[model samples]
Target: MVAGGFSELGEEGRMLEAQVKARINGTGTRVIGPNTVGVLFPHSALNTALTPNDRIYYPGKGSVAFISQSGALGLLVMDSITEFGMGVSGFVNIGNRADVTEVEVLSMFMDDPNTRSIVLYLESISDGATFFSKAMEASLTKPVVMLKTGRSEESSRAASFHTGAMATDDRVLDGVLRQAGVICAYDEVELLDYGKVLAYQSPPSGDRIAVITTAGGVGVVTTDLLTTAHDGVRLRMAAFSPEEKAELRKYALPIASVNNPIDLTADGSSEAYA
Candidate 1:
C-alpha cells in the first residue's frame, strides 16, 4: 500500500495523491501510506517494511511501538535499537499520509495490550486538534514520546521539500505537546532512551537518584547531569544512610568510598555490584 512519487513530487503528484485518498476515503480498510516504507509487527511475524530484512536487524519482542515519518530514518533507528539491545513491538512508517494519520495509529497502539510505550518521529502533523486529543488520552495510560524535527527554518524547508508538509511553530508545538503530557525527545538517541526506560521500568517515585560507578570521574559527571533541571523536573543525588553505607562497606573494597556516588574504584567486580 506504500508507494512513493506522490505528493512530494509537486502539483501533479499532489493531484495523484488526492485521487488516491478519495478512492480510499470511505473504504473500511485503513491505509498506512501512499508514500511510505510500511509496517512491521514482530509478534505477529508481519513485515511489510520496504527496507530489506537483511539491511538492518530487527529487535526482539518488546513493549515499545515506534512510528516514523521517514523510512530511512526509521531503518537507522531500528539498527540503533538492535545495537542497544532494545526491543520493539511494532514499527510504522507513515510517509505522505494519504489516508491513515499518526492519531489513528496512536489510538490503535493505546489500546494494544502488547504496547507499553509509544515513540514517534514526525516531520509534521496532519490534524493538530485530533493529534492533541489522541496523544493526551493515550499518555494517561502509557508513555508517548516524540522527536519532532523542523525546528529550524532550513530544516522546515527541507521537510516541506521531502514530504510536502508545512512545519508547525516549534515553540507552539513544544507547549502543546507538554500540556498533553507527551514526553518530547530532542533526537533519536533520546527517543529510544526514553522508550527503553518507560517500557522496562516503572515511573520513578521521586526525582532522587543514586549513582554507582567504577570510575570516579564518571560518577561526578553523572551527579551533575542528574542534578540539572530538565523541563521542570530536577534530580538530586540521594544521601546514603549510615546503615546503607555499612552494608555497602561489606561488599566494597577497603579503599572504596561509600558515599552517594558509591565509587567502588577501578577494581570493582560483580560481587561488589551485587
Candidate 2:
C-alpha cells in the first residue's frame, strides 16, 4: 500500500499515479492508493490512518464496518461515533481508488462475521452495476447504509478533484440503491444514526412504529419522518386499541395528546412515561 502521494496535485500527479499502477501490474499485488489514509482494524489494534492516535479518536471493536472515499470525513466520523459509544469492526479510506475499490472492500466486510452492518461515504461509485450487485447481496445477509455526495453540479466538480471520482445522477442512483435493499443517508449525522441503529438493533418485524416524546413538535416531526417515507421506505404508525389509549391517558396529563404519537407536552414527567 502506498500511504500517500501526489494524486491530489493535478495533471502531472495523475501521470505519476499511472506509473505506480503500472509498476504493480502483473506482480499479483494490489495497491491501495498513491494517496490515502489507509485502513484501520480496531479488533487487531491495527491503525494505518495518517493522523497520530493522540491527535485523533478511533472507534472501538464491534460490528459496523465503515468505508469512506474522503479520509477527513472518515476521521471525523470515527471520532463522532466512537464518542457516541458506537463500536466499529473496521474502516477503509479509499483515496484515489487506484486498485483496491469499494466493491472489493464491500465483499470482504460482508463476509466478515464481526461485521453486522456496513456504512459507506462515497463521492462516486467506480462500477455501478457490480457495486449494486454486491451491495444487494450484502444487504440480504446484513444491513448496508450509504451516504454518497456529488448530487449537484458544484459538488460533482469538487468530487472530481477530491478523488478523481466521476459523478452519477443521484436521482437514478437513489432508486437503484433502494432496489438493492440499501439505505441512503444524506449527511454524516444520518449516516452515523442509521449505522448505529443497524449495528445494535435488529430490524423491526412489523410495519408499526410509535413515536413518544415530551415535546409536541418533536413528536410531530418524528411522525412525519416515520410516516412519510424515511429514505424512500415508508413507516406506519401503529394502531392503538381503545383500552390502550385509556390506559395511557390515565398516566399522562389532561393536556397530553394520547394519539399514535403520544405527546406528553412539555410538562411530561417520568411517571407519565411509566
lDDT (CA) per prediction: 0.88, 0.87
TM-score of each: 0.85, 0.89
Shift of residue 222 alpha carbon in model 2, Å: 1.6
Which candidate tops lDDT? Answer: 1
Winner by TM-score: 2
The global Cα lDDT (0 to 1) of model 1 is 0.88
Model 1 clashing residue pairs (backbone) = none
What would the per-residue lDDT of candidate 1 be over residues 181-273, giving only the tens digit for each residue?
898888898899999999977657677888899989999888876776654235778888999999889999999899989899999999899
Worst 10 residues of 1 by lDDT: 225-234
Once fitted onto the true fold, the runs of candidate 1 whose alpha carbons sit more than 4 angstroms away are: 229-234, 239-259, 267-272
Can you give the lDDT of residue 185 in candidate 1? Answer: 86
Error of 1 at 24 (Å): 1.7
